[model samples]
Target: MVLPHRLSPMVSAFTALWKQRASLKTLILGDFTQNYLASYLGFAWAVLGPLVMIGVMTAVFQFGFRAGTTGSAGIPFPLWLACGMVPWQYMAEGFVTGAGAITAYRFLVRKAVFRMGYLPAIRLLAGSIIHGILLIFLVVLLFCYGASPSWHWLQVVYYFCCMFLLLLGAAWCSAAVSVFIPDIVSVISIGVNLGFWLTPIFWNLSMLPENWQIVMQLNPAHYIVQGYRDSLVEHRWLWDRPLLAHVVFFIWLFAALFIGAQIFKKLRPHFADVL
Candidate 1:
């Protein structure tokens, strides 16, 4: 049973987790040290990783697929690709990192002050630090591409928050489930790889026939990819998106949040038992 609180389970979990804010921040910092600081490549991996991924994909699209992603009249393929790539990497990292939170910190599973629910948030925090660095790199890239500074570029903040909400909601579910099922790590690994292709990061939806284009819009990541392009490439405001797109995106997001939160709350009490 969920704790005896009249507040919504999500609200309760969040509030409890908030009280441990310092520990959460410290843990996330330690995660950075643990993951990268001791390594030879060190912090350089953050920039190199995205650059290499882009290089590999660009090679494929240019040669393998002969795909011309010249990007909306002015943006060019590289800038367009960066916008979609950074946010998608954020979400993908959030899933993998958050899913492993519980097991990685199994020793703290029994600690009273360690509100287990904060595990996902802690992981997300670590990932976001790297994402923020990437965003700066993207800005430099855009300038180099001669994509003049525009106010629409600010809309990336809104899209980042949207992606954060979606990731957190999904993370809760993944973290909780993975605690009881170790195989979930592998499942999430495979799933993210599959999702990367399904998401419209590498290819443009406009490449598809009109009928299939409508269906592609249904993929929740499409909203984010388009939103990033809107901010950087298309120069469209968030409100300028079609009403149907807005409705569909929010519905998809909230469904993930609602379902994930319920699963998380139901399983939270059992976390220590399993770990």
Candidate 2:
């Protein structure tokens, strides 16, 4: 059967990524080596960068602001903050870097044989490498806080997939657009910084009034952050959340993916000229 012309680029992009998975792995590793080659600490920065950020935030909020354990579960504020911050750092880095994936690899874009589509995925996967390490740190923190492993802990995989897909969609769109308008990268950086506070990473939803809580839940990041807390701290299953929460998150996720694909498809032909 033939795919519709409109869907061909999207289907082909995914198919090519799978076929070239080996090359993708090589490119991702190359990025890691190139990134830290100049630093004395080398690849360790991947782990230390986030750990330092989380440590400072924990200090400022848990100690300076005296923001006690914010969740209803009474998990240590530092642990709760780490759970949210770990996944968030992954998303934030993916957004900022993925937006520039096209321009960053213009040489590949110029080559007729290479697919520019892989650039965004390369950025995302590279960030995932670091994300996995941070997750280990989060698990150790959880153990230190006396939190026992539970079946709910498996939901971290679900939430990680959720974030990856959401970021991929957003990356596809932002990356394609940034090729033409370089300013989009700075715009994304600003948005991610603002999103850090707006998404309730350090704060709990219960602190808000019922109506405000409903409004805040519409932000998809809220679902992922809260999902992390649920999996690691609260021991609640995905179904334990209100139905509306699930619906809102998937709606945003799918919408982002569909729209991002369409935009990337339309703008893809022009990438070579612009870049």
Candidate 3:
């Protein structure tokens, strides 16, 4: 059943992917640089975009519905929201935009040697870099409020890897599907939009009803939000002790990657035809 090349194409694909790390980085920074260069504001918008959204959400939540219930008064709820939203936004944006990446570049997909999957990977890398810069800006903004940066803050790197893999897997599936079903892009947009409220971004997860709290525990985004809170606000070690949920997250991560990779591989051959 197996048409084995002396070197499996998948093995070669992995090596190609790793070797193209510089290519990925170049694409990320290149796209980001070009986009910002078009405007006078430039990269300021990177920091400003999230800041504006946080401000708008803060006003609506803090004033209209009284949703500014994070941390405490000493730590403004806007900053707390930023702590969670920064990463969530990256995941959200990466999933939405990366989903359509393959179809968006049909010309490139038609190229004989082009790897279609890398399209989504490049999109995610770009989004992650922007999010990384926004995160550093968050640190400076937090300092303005007298929050001292602790060595524990570096733990974001570990959590970021987890978050990136989560997004990458999701992107792989969505991008692959989008090639066959154009409608998938619309569905993904709706899901990302809905995910914002479903996950605990503006409010504390602990405040949910006991049953709902238990139910929401299944959302991987919850763990990511908790990771951010733990590393930044709680001034504590990230997920100090592993539990069933951590196991579930790893299981979910592996399962998603496995399924996504298989799905992407299965569908890849037909992409040029479909696109």
Candidate 4:
């Protein structure tokens, strides 16, 4: 009585999950509420958490350690750092969370009735909310600093979508691989931690010798971080990215998605056995 699915795996997977979208949304929203909004000023913690860290970092670097004191244009170091950090916070969350999605919901994986390919999409849904709050906080800080709004600032929306697309692709790869290699979860954690310092978030990329810039730009997160700072603090357009940067980012993105989809479909049937 098992009728084989005639649709392509991707289409068949979507066909299975499409009907559950409503329930899934409700489940995700409910989880978000419980985790971040259930207590007094609970959700407020999301914004306050990063703001506090940024403040401490600013104070430490500007006073105690005396690093990243130089800011681009007239923008302060903290402001510039915050703009980049906002996107990174969301991006890191998606990647880290997605990597554990399969293991975290092992019960669902065993059910064999649920469509697992959407795990990456589901991982970042709640994260986008936190990203919005951080965006507002960044804007308020800029306004308080007497920065004027400009047409270029409007490109944050484009950059937001850009980061999300990047997140989707990365999430797919991380989620799929981690199911097979549990150590990938730890790898992602250590990688994100190390990547923060390695990336040009706290320090400007210009600090490096001009010749070494492309090497650092190899990290796709660098492109997004730079995009955020350029849009918010430097007032640059989305299309203004260098040609090579565009080529590298798109290549990594599409490749991640294509390979991720293939791996996800191939190993998906075996999830129950391992889980």
Q: Indicate which candidate wins on TM-score.
A: 2
Error of 1 at 120 (Å): 0.3
User: Which model is ahead, 2 or 4, in terms of lDDT?
Assistant: 2
Q: How many clashing pairs per prediction, in order?
A: 0, 0, 0, 0
> What lDDT does each candidate get?
0.83, 0.87, 0.78, 0.78
lDDT of 3 by residue, 2-116 (tens): 5455334344445677988877677667656665656788668766887899889899888888754566445578778888899888888888888888876788888887777
- Which residue pairs does candidate 1 place in steric collision? none
Give the Å shift of residue 147 in candidate 3: 1.6
Compared to the true structure, candidate 1 yields what TM-score?
0.91
Off-target runs (Cα >4 Å) in candidate 3 are 1-14, 33-46, 63-69, 72-74
lDDT of 1 by residue, 87-200 (tens): 888888887888888888888889876677787887888888889999988889888977688999899989988888788888889888999898998899899999899888
Better of 3 and 4 by TM-score: 3
lDDT of 4: 0.78
lDDT of 4 by residue, 1-275 (tens): 55335325545555655788896797578657765789988788876887887888799887787664455666777887798789889887778887877777687786666678766667677778888889988989999988888787878887777777677667767787787899998999999899988898777788899788879999889888888888888877767778899899888776666666667777877888887
Better by TM-score, candidate 2 or 1: 2
lDDT tens string, model 2, 89-197? 8988999999998988888887888887898999898888888888888888888877787889999999999999899889999999998899999999999999998
TM-score list, all predictions: 0.91, 0.93, 0.87, 0.86
Better of 2 and 3 by TM-score: 2
Candidate 1 has its poorest 10 consecutive residues by lDDT at 1-10
Model 4 scores a TM of 0.86
